[model samples]
Each structure stands twice: as C-alpha cells, then as structure tokens.
Target: MKIHINQLEEGCILAKDILSASNKVLAYKKTIVTEHIKHALKAFLVNEVHVENLLEDGRGFLPSGIQKEASNEEKEKVELTPVKTFHQLYNHAVMERKQLFTGWQSGTQIEIAKVRQIILPLISELKHQEGEILKLYQYCKKEDYLSHHSVSVALLSAFLAKRLGYDQGEINQIAITGLLCDCGMARISPVILTKKVTLTEREYLDLKQHPVHSYNLLKSIMSLKEGVKMGVLQHHERMDGSGYPLGVKGDQAHPYSKIVALADTYQAMVSERPYRSKQSPFKVLEQIMQHDFGRFELNAVNELKKAVIKFSAGTKVKLSNGLKAEIVFVDEQFPTRPIVKIEKTGDITSLKDKKELYIQEIF
Candidate 1:
C-alpha cells in the first residue's frame, strides 16, 4: 500500500492520513491520490504514504510508473509522431479545455489524469523551446476565448514561474493553477459565458463567485496540493484587497494564486474580447507598475517584465506606426522600447525618444 510520491497517479485511494513533519494532519485517510499530489508530497517532504490496493473505482492496481519495458515499435511510434508547433499545441490544449469545461458545466466530476494528459506535454514543449508563445493572444477569437484564455494563462504562468526561479515541480503545479483558475466559471450560466453585451450588475456578481466555485470543485480532491486548490480559489484576490470572492490580500493569497492572477490579468488584457480591443503587453505591464501597484506581487510582476522585455540585436519587430524595423540595440534600463533601424528609410530611432511609438510585435 506504501509508495513514493512520484509514483502517484489518479484513482489511488489514501489508506492513511498525510501529515507534516510536525505530525499535523494535512489530508485525512480515504482521500483520493491524484492531480497535484506529487507537488504536495514534495512540498511536504513526505517520502511515501499508505494507499489502498485497489483504486478508488475498485479496480486492481499497478503503479503507472512501474510499467513494463516498451517494445522498439512503441518507442519508434512515439518518435515518428511529428512534433507540434507552439500554436498547434496551444490550439489542441484549448479544444481539450473546452470539452473539459463543458463536462464540468454538466456536473461531471474532474479526472485529474485527463487534466495532466491535456496539459503536461504542451507545457514541456513550450518550456523546452522558449517558442514564440507570448503572441498567442493574436490568434484568439471571440468564440473560443474562454479555452484560449485558460491555455494562455497556463503558458505565461509557467514562464513566469521559471523566471521567478521555482523548481520544476512547483512550476508545474503553478501551470495547473493557471489552467484551472477559471474552472469555477463552468458553474455560471452559459448565457453569461457567451454573452455579447455587458453583464447586468446581478450577473456580474454571480460571475465573481467563480473563484469560490472553482475552490469547491478542486477542494474535494484530497491528493491535490492545498496551495494549488487555494491558488485556484484565490486567483482573483488582490494583494491590496480590491479583488473578489474572499478579497484576501497580501500573504493571505497563496503565491501560486498571485502568479495565476498576474498571468490571468495580463492575458485578458492582451487578448481581444467582444467588448474591448487588446493592448500591448508592454503598455499593460507599464500600467500595472504605475497604476495597479500594490494589487499584484512585485516579484511576479518583475519576472513578467523580464520575460516580455527579452529582446536582442537584429531581432525583427513592428512599430506602432506600422513600419517594420530591426533591433539595433536594447538598453537594459529601457527594455520595453528597444532602439531599432527602420526598414523604410534606414533611419535609426531610439524608442525611448519616440514616446508615441512602441514595438508592437517581434516577428
């Protein structure tokens, strides 16, 4: 019944309580071992735990990680599959998320295994390639906005976590936190979800309770890390107590929650909506620093800044005035506005001096 944390897979039932080093109960016995349990066990430094021989569905158990050796054909088949581009992966994840959200709306229980299969490979590819993923907002359409939003937030959050120096395990959990932060919205009316017009005050209020709904959905999965569950619940909460559901502020919000909140806000601002046009992430980041100060964690904000401002000499870009240019120099102090040589006249312009212009895209 006892097994290591990395060996955890969905449907494994806990046979004993999960306790901290201080012997404080973290999760009670009879809980399901699934979802973010690996991260939680690593976070707690719990080496192993007792589990039921049969899975939660009463099926016989064989540890998934303890699989038989793969045949050469199986390995060849995996290698033969064409690698997906970042956009391709993003689109696939969005479709998968849409189906999952629909199921959640219909009151189906979440299967953590499916969630992992949907996201983990996509996450791995992005992290490995550092691909042109930030501009995924450009691909968004009104009809698929919800699913697109979830996938974007997950990618951005994972990038920010890496920039913030989290270990791989913690970063993975944060990515899931981003992906599921809005899962509670499934419980909201479909009319509200797909509405073209502004929500009524009452409808808006109902929409705001999504964090609580998301928390409720995730809270019952005992093997999931508490921080991840709390992260989903508090994604809308602000550090300054201006956010909704619980209005929790400062350290009262989980760090993962803060990361999700930051990614969610950034992605929402950049992705076009039915009501508002998208803005440049540079503009949004500047606004967050100058105006939305105290509402977000500064480290998360800085990591996002670093991620977005990364540019080098000779990188091609588009300016706000619609001219294509090539980066000539990037001042670390003035990262958002890099100096470039305009393709039209070969005129070198220091973006810092052109207050009205900013780099729109790096092609």
Candidate 2:
C-alpha cells in the first residue's frame, strides 16, 4: 500500500525502491525499515513509500478516518494550475521523447507535428506563469537527463526569446528549435551517453557529431523553416568560431542558433549529470559572465542574465557562510551578487562589496 513517509513504520518491508527527485534509488525494494531508515528517508526529502504485507484493514498503518481511495471522477477532476499542469506536461513530454527517439533510431520518419504537440502547450502555459516555469527548472532529474534537458532548454529559450522582445510566432519557433536541437543524440550509443567517467578524446569527437546528425534528421521535415533547421544544425556553433560541426564565427552563424546555444549551455551547466553534481544557478551565471562573454553572443547572454535575475531576486537563499537570508535587491551591474537581508539579525549585506561571500543555494 502507498503511504505518506510520516506513516512509515519500523519492520515494514519496502515494496519498491524509494527514489530521489534526481531518480537515484535511495532505498532498495524488500528492505526492512528501521528507525534509522526512516530518518534517512526524511533526510532524502522522500514524500511517500510503498509498504508490503498490509494488515487485515488493508489500509495498514494509516491513521483512522483517512480516506483509502477517491472516486474515479474525483481523481480525474483534480484541477491543475498552470505550474502544476506544466509538470504533468513535462513528464508526458519526457516519456514521449523517449519513444520518439527510439523510433528515430529505427529509421522511422520524423514527425514535426508530434514535436509541436509536445512544445506548443508548454509555450502557451509559460506565457501565463513564467516565474513558476523558471522555478521548475531546478527539478529536472539527472537520470532522465536527455529529455529533461530538452524541456529545460525549450523553456529557457522561450523565456530568453520573450526577454529579447521576439513576437509570439518567433517565440514558438525558437522553443521548438530548442526542443529538437539535441535529437541527434538518439543516434549515439547509450553506453557513451550514460558513462559515469570522463569520455576519451575519440568518444568526445563522436559525441560532437550529434549536431550534424540532428541537422540531417531535421532537414527532412518539410514543415520546419530554414531558420529552425539552421538552429538545430548550428546550436553548438559558438560566436568565437570555437564550436563544433561548422566552427562558424558570430557574423557567420544564424541569430536563432545563437539564442538556442546560450540556453543549451546554461541548462547543461545547472543540471546534474552522471559525471558531476549540479552547480548553483548563481555560480553558472557568474561563470558565463566571467569567461563566456566572447564564446556566446553578448545580447543572448545579457538577456539570459536579465531573465534569471528577474525571477531569482527576492528569493530566500543560503549563504556560503552558512547563514540563511532573503535577497532584497538585484543590482543591474552585478546580477549574480544581490543584496541580501539576513534572516536571524535583520542585517542587510551587499554581496557586491563582500566578494568572499556567495549564495550557496536557493531555499
């Protein structure tokens, strides 16, 4: 029976493994729970668990008066707000993307309409609740990195496009471009994709071929525009002629491709991968500002910084010094380091002057 984590009891056997938000197994199936195990689950932020061998009541250890089940209509009628709806849609997109990639690997014809079905609703929902969408970016799982990264790039691309004052039609097209930019990964081997160690030089070279592969697949779609095709083909191409496939300079690359590239890099850095833990958004932004100015188009990076600061300012955060604080202001000149108000003493600290202090996490 499924039960809340708080209801978990000693001696209860796990029916299934408990997984973290990143999809890593925390507790294995058939493991008997003990007091220490319960504490560990709480520390892992687990919300629910499945227990085997229920008592005669079938409800097991659930407190009295709690409903065991809801009516079909009641369950089906649960209203989802824009953000909640986006989560459901994102999960659907990930599963569908997996199937779509498998079909592509089998040489099946790629369908542009199916891609639209996955991206259009997300774009529409983002127009209403962009902040919620930004907040959800941090929840992307490491295990399903490909699909989650695709969705995240699409969202960030659309957000950046809007910030750049792109028209509605342009925004939708950019979002779709972001969604399929990495579809070429379907042609790569799963072992290379999920390697826990650093890839060798040859493996990295083969991995870089994905952009060209993606372009070849996307070029066959008659419905895709020239700009969209180029975006997928050159999303990895850098402004300084340092990217793969074409090595095109800033003037040589398409503007849409540059936007997607910026979004892609940001999403990849902030996401947890098999090889490395996730970095804080502030750290990623700081790195981009300090080192990536010449590699990415200036306007695209600036717009991304603006979008990030707009949503991230005023959020409660943990400081590097181990103090809890709430951001009070964001300086346009230094977007990464904002003014924060300490939670304990009501002291205002400006991160700009205090270079030693940094934000550790968003609470």
Candidate 3:
C-alpha cells in the first residue's frame, strides 16, 4: 500500500526500494521506518511510499477507510524528487561545464568563481560519502560527451585522491584540476573534436597538444593553486615517457596529474562513445591491470581496482557467458577475474583460465 508522508508512522516497513532520480538506491526495500528516515524522506519531498501491508510492530499499515493499494499508474506517479542528491549536483555540474566549454571556444577566460561553484558542491558530496564511480556511465550522452567526460574525470580523480589518503585541501585542488585538464580541447577546432572518422596526421598531432593548450589557458589564472595549474598541463604525460606533449616521464609528471590521468583513462574506456559502445566494467579493469602496467601509477590503479570490484565470497553475479554464479574465491593479483561456482550446474570455474568470461554485473 502506498501512503502519503503525512500518514507515515514508525515501524512501517518499506515494500519497495526508494530510488533517487538517478536510480541510486536511497532506502532499500524491507527497511523499517525510523525517525531519521522519516525526516529524510520528508526533506527529499518523497510524497508517497510503497510499504508492506503490515507494520514492524504487527499493526495494519493502512486504516480501515483508507485505500489498501494504489494502481500501477499511481505507483508511477510516486516519483521521488531528491533535490539535494549527488544526481542533481552532478547534472548541474555537467551543464555548467557545457556552458564553460562553449565560452572557452569563443575565447572566454576561465572563470574561477563559476568553476568553484561547480566544484564545491561536488566535493561536498564526495566528502559526504564514497560514491560508486563505476555507475557514472548512466549520465554520459554521446552527443554531449565532452561535458560528461570532464565532470566524470574530475569525480574519479578526486575519488582516487581520497583513497590515496590525501587531505581534504589537496583533494579539492585535485578535483578542480581534473575538471579543467581538458580545457585545452576547447582550442581545437569543432570539426576535429567531433570528427567521426579517423583523424589525419596533422589533426592527430594538433589534438595531442591539448595538454599544452590547457596549461597555457590555466597559467594566466592567478588565484588558482600552482599544482592545479601543473596537473592540468601534465595530465596526459605517462610514467614511462610514452605520453604526448612534453613527453615527461616518471616524477616529471605531477602526482595529482597521475591521479587525473588514471581517472581520465578509466572514464574514457567505460563511457559510451560515438564510434564504439561502452565495454563492461570488469573488462575495462582487467585490461587496465593486465595491459597498461607502468603507463599509470600502481597505487592509483590499485585503489580503483579495490573500490570498483570488491570481491567477496558468496556474492551473486551474472557472468559474461550469460550464466549466474556465486563468487567462491578472489585472487588478490587478479581481482577482476574471480573463481565462481555456477548457479545451475554447481560447477566451479576459474575466470583467469577462461579468458573469454568476466563478471557482467553484481545482483
């Protein structure tokens, strides 16, 4: 039965998962209503709740005169408006980046005030709790992907910084730096930026210089911290001297830049693009850990690996081969590929041996 917030009482059990606009879980189903939860539901303007017929205290949830259940149409009407969730903050940041990117295309200088406005809320949300960076693909749109990529890179970079135990002040600087790392891309021609076909040699060379362009654009902003400016400039530099622009290797690249680079690379792989569909998260992680050794800092990549694919025994997951299974073991060296027991046949399979299969998703 769905009831109004005014009718909510302690001990009423949630019958369905309460989700935010972004489809993020707010309150899981079967959670018993508590005072704090009631207040949160009200603050988020959740007008209705689909609760079990009986309360936790063994009382009827609905009064005798009240409607026992709402129709499917009514259920659809019970949309939750989490105005202050990360979803809202993230969407606004994406639009803010879109507008800023457009302004940059026309020779507008980087506005530190507007930039802070975009970064602060996001940083605050990050401080509030650790978010699932793997789920950021839900917000990416191929048509406006540049804006999406900017915000996601910033978030992933910031997440890596925090996981690395950086202080809040350092984390804030890294977050802003990550967002502006691609600011140089604005200087590139739109024709080149959005080209669907292969780029000519000249165009490819020009695109590779974006980090230098980004550095020049940020160097003029006096209020920005020194490291923030440097991070944007060196984001593309690889640890093994394989990267472009200055081609600085090892410590020549700033530490913050390495975090941004790691996040930037990961986001690009998982996000959908016009030329190719997005790959599985496990697949991306597997490739990153297996193939991209020495290209990215081990500490940053390891932290991301631990956070994204935290393996535990008995965890239910769907396999790439379209079979359901329970994880039975996790090899620390290759966490992305774990040993699992097939659900139907009760047979064990080692993912490292079967190179073709990987985890599709966790249920």
Candidate 4:
C-alpha cells in the first residue's frame, strides 16, 4: 500500500499494513495526529473512549509510503541492550506489592536487597548518561512499568541535576526525590491500579490526588528534606498552572518540582503505559523540546537534552529507511541524527552528513 507521511500536519498512513492500536505502527501524518493517535490508542486499548473528541483529528488526511528493508547485516548490528536485571527488579516490585496486598506471609527481603544493590550503583552512574538512560530503561514491560518508571526517573533526574551543575548532594537529592516520587500510589486501590480500561473522571481525580498522598507518605519518613517533600508534592504541577493537586504556576513551584517534572514527563513518554506503547526516546525528547521554552525551565530542559544524547552512545537504532545501525556517538549540537555505523557494507552515516537518511525512531 502507498504511504504518506503528512496528513493532519504530522501523522502517517499505511497502505498494506493493518492498522490497530496494539500494533507498533509509528508513522503519523502530522505531529499532532501522531500524538492524538497515541493518546487515543492508549484510551482505546484500555477502553478509555469517554473523551469522544479525542480520536477526531482536526485536519484528517491520509499519507502513504512504500515499505523498505535493511540489509541482514544491518539488522544484526541493531540489538536491544539487555535490561535483564532491571526488568527483574521491576517485576519484583510488582510481585512484592501483590504479595503484600494479598496478605501473603512476607518473604521477599532478598529481592528488595537485590534491587537496591543494582539500583544504587546504577544511580551512581546515572549522572553521566543523560540520553542513554531511557534506552536502558525501555526493557520494562507492562507489569513492571510503574516500578521501572520510578527507577528510570530517579536515574534521569540524577543525571540531569549533575548536568545542570548541581553538586553531589543536590544530585543525590534529585535522585531520591525521583525514587520516591510515586510512593503514594502504594496506598491507592488495586482495582484502579490494575485496571485494563481507561481511567474514569473519578479515577483520574483519584490518581491526581496521588501527589498529596505521596507528600503525606514522605512526611512519615523523617529523612526527607523540605525540598524533597515539596518535590514529591509538586512534581505534577505545571508552569502554566495546568497540572493538578495544587495549581501553582511559574516561580511559585519549587526548583526541585521543575526538575522532577521534566524527568517524570521524559520517563513516562519513553516508557510504555497502559494506554500507549513507548515512543522513541528521540521523539520523546523532540516533544519535550517543543514544550521546553514555555512549559519548562530553559536551562534544565537543555541540560536534560544534552544528557540524553550523551547516554545514547553505542546504541542500535532503526532509521526511517528501515535500515538498522548502531550509533557511534551523537553530535551535541545536532541530536536527531548522529554518527551511525550502518551494517550494510559497513558504511558510516552521519545524520548531519547523510543527505537522504533520517532516524525514524530509536529502538
């Protein structure tokens, strides 16, 4: 089937490929269309179709293109870095929660210790890997998502804080704030937590209340500082006053809140959710950049962006042409395309230098 990449200003259309929410179809006609589709599919997959207007594209159109394949060697060069240990940790968190909820006679201290052992060292290295942190965290699946999300955000936050030139204490605090950001969710009902359907308005309201829940939970932990508590409470608040729990805007929000917001949004976008599969980290960064100036602090956003690029070194990715390759290194200035090693004929392609090549997504 013929495919077009422009329809509603930024989504894509498929000719022969089947269109379904469950499938990993990433093309969109307009950027908005793609975002809309993502939101809709998540809602659809979870049966959260109450927002009827959501699926309606303001400028609906179809775009199509031909499918292409990369050389066999190219495919071999692109591999998902194993997140095996992290995956197990995330799974353990879920299992721990389940056993706790089910009233099973406790028995997972070793697992918790294992997770801590892995996480502590990873957190230590997090500050150096801005871009690659998301890639490393993508190994999570649905069951372990929330657990993975908390850990991923902590890692990213630590890295981002260091990049912004925060001292070690400040960096560690950022990581701690991120690690405990969602601790309040442990108090929420499992019925809402494990639901496969889209959240109802009431459910969303409850979910929004989680920041407060988180704040309260942290209050019991005496080791947390005022800034850390504030970060837990206000991380969801937006600069535009559009976020929830408390509608504080701009400078009213704490510095930690701003940092947490960036880390949270970035982590969520790259991690799979009940409603939608994760998008490419590059795409997530692009979206973040699009909103950076107005919705987020400028320096923080730029620093986080730099961290992500640096972390993506030696990662394999799929290009727009369906070719697979490994990223040798990324240019700080030009992030979308970096120096890549294409498996096909061992050609070295640079996004800056390659005239016809474009990165479709980073796997």
lDDT of each: 0.79, 0.80, 0.81, 0.63
TM-score of each predicted structure versus truth: 0.75, 0.74, 0.73, 0.62
User: Which pairs clash (backbone N, Cα, C closer than 3 Å) in model 1?
Assistant: none
Off by over 4 Å in 4: 1-121, 125-132, 328-333, 337-342, 345-363
TM-score, predicted candidate 2 vs. hidden true structure: 0.74
Per-residue lDDT value at 340 in model 2: 94
Error of 3 at 8 (Å): 20
| Model 1 lDDT per residue over 292-347, tens place | 99899999988776766663467787888999999888776776777899998999
Instruction: Sort the candidates on TM-score, descending order.
Output: 1, 2, 3, 4
Candidate 4 lowest-lDDT run of ten: 45-54
Residue-wise C-alpha lDDT for candidate 4, range 1-363, written one tens digit per residue: 122222222233322222232243332222223444434333322221111112254333442352223234423322323333544544544454344323312321213233334345556444333345656446656676666677777777777787788998887777777776787777677778778679999998888888897787667555557898899898998888888788998999988888989889888887777677777777677667765557876788888677667667887788868899888988877776689998686788887777577665566
lDDT of 4: 0.63
| Highest TM-score model number | 1
**Model 3 stretches with alpha carbons more than 4 Å out:** 1-82, 311-318, 322-329, 340-349, 360-363
For residues 1-363, could you state the per-residue lDDT of candidate 2 as single tens digits?
A: 898888877666679977654455667776666666677776655678899867864434433553444334432322222324656767877788778877887888789888888777677767767876445546778778888889889888888888888998999899999999999998888889999899999999999999999999888788999898999999999988999898998879887898999889988987888897777678788998898879998988888777767887779888889999999899888988999999999999999999999887775
What is residue 5's positional error in candidate 2, in angstroms? Answer: 40
lDDT of 4 at 284: 70
Candidate 3: which pairs clash? Answer: none
